[model samples]
Target: MIKSMTGYGCGARDNHKVKYTVEIKSLNSKFLELTLRLPKAFSDKELTLRSECTRLIERGKVNITVTVEYVDQTAAAATINTELLKNYFRQLEAVANELGTNRGNLFELALNMPEVISHNEEEADEEEAALLLNAFQEAVAQLNEFRKDEGVVLKQDLSTRTQDILRLLTEVEAVETDRIPLIRDRISQYMDETVGKENVDMNRFEQELIFYIDKLDITEEKVRLRSHCNYFLQALDAADANGKKLGFISQEMGREINTLGSKANHAGIQQIVIRMKEELEKIKEQLLNVL
Candidate 1:
């Protein structure tokens, strides 16, 4: 079955120490393009996360955002520089003595100094990583489900459009029968009027008419176009990433339809060919989002 490249998914987990939220958004792209946002502590695991996303999403412009909120205040434990604080206080006291100014809030000012309070870098925890991975997997699963649902709609539209083109092809066949005879009669009447019926060479005229009709015959194009349409449907039914393949088939279908249009001298057949082209164009537009 075909899958659409556009989708959105989110998964979140909240616990005592931390809260993990994963959001994934995707849009149609020719290749798998990924943009990942991760916490600094999890920066080392970015490659693993990217690889996992690439494995699941073959083609799309994918954006993944991971939010890690620390619920426990102690998660980011801060240490005070006692020595620095005391040194600042002593310096401030000396300045106060020299200038005879009150050292009001001196302790608070010292505590607010740069580097006086610093957080210790926490080591990566395997358990927390596993939990985050679980959330990430859930988000991916949800995205796949979204893609599948969108794929069903695309499949239906594409299939219906293909059938419409086939119906137009049948209409072309209906009008095609009278086209050659009309051409022959028109040419014969013109020759009889200009060159006189007795002077015309019937044998030579028959040979030339046969050659002309053969050049304009759309039998091969119609057969090939039908085959291409069937192949497109088959690929859509099979389990694989056939977006590019479908595009190639659509191009082939376009070629046949154009050929039919050019060869169809009859006005009714050309109109039917135009309708076929319109349906094929719709299929191409929808294929852009298919994977």
Candidate 2:
């Protein structure tokens, strides 16, 4: 049950005190990269929110935006001490310049400083915070559902491409059965033309022929390729597609297929190997979106 790394979800909750809206969007990425933007009032809970997002999303480039609409605009207006903020910013900028640290986030840093935002000496509104948390949870749940749906589509595409490669593998096997005989006959005919057939030692010729044919043999490659494909298909059906695991399996498949191609003296088998490689490339592309 793999999930896709791409999705969008939004959740909203409103009450007499305030309203909260949370929107989350995710895209494919090799690791978890989260960018969260919320009102400064919830700064204390930022770490908790981030931890929860990481737990749920697992991995992706995720962007979360939270919007808060208070019923009392006048009350919200008086929340920030502007003069204090300006003073804090000036000091922070001077300190940053003196320390040779970054000054890009001076305003944001000053805004989050203690006493910069005051609610008339009262504690934070627990009820409003709970509402926002609930909205965020809803958004994450919706996002998970979206990912699951997309995962189904990815799963189907991967399965089809893998089966196509397996089918092409069988085609390679069919052509491979005639390879040894063809190589033996071609070499014998060449010897007959270059040196009279009577001059060739039949026993030594047979021994050398066996050794040459053994070098071109693709039996082990075919077996390993088939095994890798079967393992890939099995992994696809697991609880999580585990992209890294599938990627490793695909790499193994590629090694075997490449060996098959290099050793394949027959043009028909080579063409089939080309098809398998194409199918495998498609599989790898789809795996990029898998979770």
Candidate 3:
């Protein structure tokens, strides 16, 4: 069960003349990095919201936005700064008297200063808070649903690619087996060319041939590659949020593949190694989105 790290979901609830909306967006990340946007009144709930998102999404660069709108007049509570206004008026009266300028609009000018008409950024009631949190929960659920759906497609493609790698491995094995007899014949021909056919040292030649063939043998690489494939599938099954683990396994798989390529002296085996590398590359691309 693989899940993509990219998804989006939005949920909204309106009640008692207040409307709460929550939206979540996720993108691939090396770790769980969450950014939350909320009204000042709800700032205290940031940690709670982030924690809930972490538990749900597991890994990603997640951005969550919460908006609460008041549909009623009470939602906008304006407060006047009486002391500041009085002081402003007194200072302006003196300034106007000294400069011989009009003081008629001084009060209006003072009223327009920042913070003079402060309003309580609307706060949700307890019931409204519950609704908001519920909406957030729903958003996270929907986001994960989208990721899961994408994950199904990814899993199918990756499984196909894994099978392709296996096929290429089989081709490499065939090429490997065919090389041994070819090497024996070439060694015999070389011995005949260097020394007279009657003077050929059969025992020494056979031993040397065996040693050279063993050096070119990819049996260990094949065995380890096959084992890595099986281990990869097992890890995939056990993985919950194992993107990094999968990546590490991929590195090991690549090591074996590279070794197989380097040891391959046959043209067919080289071609198979190329195909295997292509499949592995595709798997690596898909792994980027896995969680």
Candidate 4:
């Protein structure tokens, strides 16, 4: 089944005093690219979170944002580092004495220095973190489900486009068969007119006609294009991410279609080639969103 690379999923859960919300957005890409925005407290889980997303999403350019709202007011308290402050105070007192200045408010000055007032946050509880992980998993699962549903729609649209191309191919093939004999007869008449009727060698003319017809023949191109169309359908049916593979196949199909256009010299065949190109272009545009 095919899945689109574009989708959105959001989830939220509250545990004790912390409320967590996870939002994920994905877009088409040649490789798996991930960008994450998370709270500073959860920075330790960055690698693990990215790994989990990689394992679950498979492929795409995915952006994940995690928002944490702490509901509790009792955050860690800030306190002066008494020992460090004392050391600073002692050094300052020595310098002040040499300079003949009073050591007034020296402790207060030392306390104002950075890292002096440490919050000494409590160690994060592993269980609470586990809850967060579980919530994240649920959110990812919901995201994948949304993508799957979107994929069903994409699959139907792409299949219809493929059928359109096949129909055009059939039309072109029919026109080529009818055009070949007429082209050969016209060539023969032109040759007979240029040379005297009796001087025109019928056997040699027939040989040249065969060679000319063969050069303009698109039978091989039609066959290869049809085969490519069939393979595209097969790839779409497989239960894997086949966006890149589908893109490659479409390129090959385009190659055959272009070759057919170049070889088709008949007005009818050229008209059909134009229609075939239109259909193929539509298919290629749609394939960009598939995975």
Best by TM-score: 3
Model 1: per-residue Cα lDDT over 1-291, one tens digit each = 889999999988766888789999999999999999987778888999988987888889999999877788787687999999999888888888899987887888888888788763334477778878989999999999999999999999999999888878888888788899999999999999999999999999999999999999999999998888888888889887478999999999999999999988889988888889889989999999997
- The deviation in Å at residue 247 for candidate 3 is 2.0
Better of 3 and 4 by TM-score: 3
Instruction: Give the per-residue lDDT digits (tens) of candidate 3, residues 1-291.
Output: 678899999998877677889999998988898988988777777788878877888899999998877778587667898988887778888999999998889999888876667776644457877878988988988999999888888777877888788878887766676688877888788888889789977888778888998898888999999888877777766646367888898889999999998988778888888989999999999999888
Instruction: Return whichever of 1 and 2 wins on TM-score.
Output: 1
Ten-residue segment with the worst summed lDDT in candidate 3? 116-125
Off by over 4 Å in 3: 92-109, 112-114, 122-125, 187-200, 237-241
Better of 1 and 3 by lDDT: 1
Where model 2 places Cα greater than 4 Å from the true spot, the runs are: 79-123
Stretches of model 4 off by over 4 angstroms after superposition: 76-113, 116-123
Tell me the spans in candidate 1 whose CA falls farther than 4 Å from its real position: 77-123
lDDT of 2 by residue, 1-291 (tens): 888999989999987757889999999999999999988778888999999987989989999999877776654554888999999999999999899998889999999998898763143478878988999999999999999999889988988998898889888877777788889999999999999899999999999999999899898998999899999999989876688889899999999999999999999998998888899999889888887
TM-score of 1: 0.86
Clash count of each predicted structure: 0, 0, 0, 0
After superposition of all CA atoms, the RMSD between model 2 and the true structure is 7.4
Query: 2 or 3, which is superior by lDDT?
Result: 2
Stronger candidate by TM-score (1 vs 4): 1
Question: What Cα-based lDDT does every candidate model obtain?
Answer: 0.88, 0.89, 0.84, 0.81
